[model samples]
Target: MYRPPHFAVDDLPTQQALIRAHPLGLLVVAGPGGLTADPIPFLLDAGEGPFGRLRCHVARANPVWRTIGAGAEVLVVFQAAEGYVTPGWYETKRETGKVVPTWNYALVQVHGRARAIEDTDWIATQIADLTALQEAARPEPWAVDDAPAPFIAAQMRGIVGIEIPIARIEGKWKVSQNRPEADRSGVAEGFAAQGAAGAAMAGLVRDFGRERG
Candidate 1:
């Protein structure tokens, strides 16, 4: 992550918030077979370590869990809102025509050592917790016990659990913080006009800009 001072977010709580909001992370690992990347939904235990602990799972057939040895370093990238910002959004575009297009986004990168767990109890608890987290917002929440016991057991047998105790974490929030106040406000307004797709970035721009002031 190339984090300029203005775009850097070093606060632990802020980074954890982004991860919780966007639980799906890109898991990257390097091993004897080379590098592999997979999109996986994660559960974060913020109090587990200095940074945090990440829990996820992979299909048993997937080589990722098998290729990486115990304590191998891995990266999990959690990306929140992101959008393209046109130069037209900057007030400077009108003043001096010097503004260029850029991207505005909020993301967190977690570096940790992974541990593969085959314990059925651990995997069962992991799946239950993950399910609760995702289903809590639903009108009728589902649970592991909602299905037949044998069916659920068979399904669980096909996956392996992965745990990572975070060694370091980095957060980047490039939401026009590098721009001047007027330019940042212009960008926010431009994004606001875009409706739902732009709402998150617009809020980020406003929040980060206020922090700058």
Candidate 2:
């Protein structure tokens, strides 16, 4: 992630929150053939290492498990995105004419070492815990044990669990932090005016301004 100083976001708490809130991530790993990426829904198990660990599962037939071996480094990319930033929002666009169109969003890059959950008991626990966490967020939460024993066992057997001990995290928040206050305010108001995702991004721009104050 190449980030300029004005666009850099080094806040750890913010990064973790971004990753957690955006449960779906792109897990990328290298293998003999080439690089592979999987869009997976993961659980952030927050009690393992200092930065905790990431938990996810892949279909047993998916070759990704074999490539992501013990101690193999992996990159998990989470996108906490909003909307596009229009050039007309910037005051400089009409004044000095020094601004161009850019995107406004947040993202996190977590680097970790992976270990395959091979133990049957541990794998079962992982499946249960993951299902519980995901269901907890729904309107009518579904329990993992709701399924029949034979069906659940069969389903579990078809998947492989993964545990990623996070080694490092890098965050980038590009919500017009590089702009001056006047331009920032102009952008915020512009976003709020559009009544799209831009409206939420405006709040992020405003928050960053408040923090710098």
Candidate 3:
């Protein structure tokens, strides 16, 4: 992730929060066939390592886990939020007509050595944790125990676990931080008025500005 200083998010807590909120990540690996990317929902255990540990499962039928050795290096990419930013949204556009369109977004990248887990017990626990995390906010939360044990066990057999002990972590928050305060404010208000596509990004921009203060 090529990030400029203004857009860099070096805070560990913030990065972890972003990962937890946006759990689905693109897991990429290299193999004899070539580079492969798999989108999988992950569980981030920040207390497990200096940076953290990431856990996810891939379908047993997917050849990725088989070809990419357990010791292989992998990168998990998580996209938090992103939206198109029109130049007209910047106050500078009217002042100098020098501004161009860009994008406002937040993302995190985790790099680590991945290992495959075939142990049924480990997979079972992972399934439970993942299920609980995702269902926590639902009005009617679901749990792995809600299903028949035999059925759950059978389903688990079709997937394999991939664990990454985080060696490196990077976060980038490009939310108009490079622009002047007036311009930044304009962007936030502009995004807010743009409806769903920009509403989330608008909130992020405002929150980021508050942090800077």
Per-candidate Cα lDDT values, in order, are: 0.92, 0.83, 0.90
**After superposition, candidate 3 runs with Cα above 4 Å error:** 210-213
lDDT at position 15, candidate 3: 97
* Consecutive 10-residue window with the lowest summed lDDT within model 1: 204-213
* Candidate 2 pairs with clashing backbones: none
Model 2's TM-score against the true structure: 0.91
Residue 103's C-alpha lDDT in candidate 3?
83
Model 1 clash number: 0
Our model 1 lands, by Cα RMSD against the true structure, at 1.3
What is the C-alpha lDDT profile of model 1 across 77-101, one tens digit per residue?
A: 9999999999998889999999788
Candidate 3 global CA lDDT score: 0.90
Deviation of model 1 at 106, angstroms: 0.9
Task: Answer with 2 or 3, whichever has the higher TM-score.
Answer: 3
Highest TM-score: give the candidate number: 1
TM-score of each: 0.97, 0.91, 0.95
Runs of candidate 2 exceeding 4 Å displacement: 210-213
Question: How much does candidate 3 score in TM-score?
Answer: 0.95
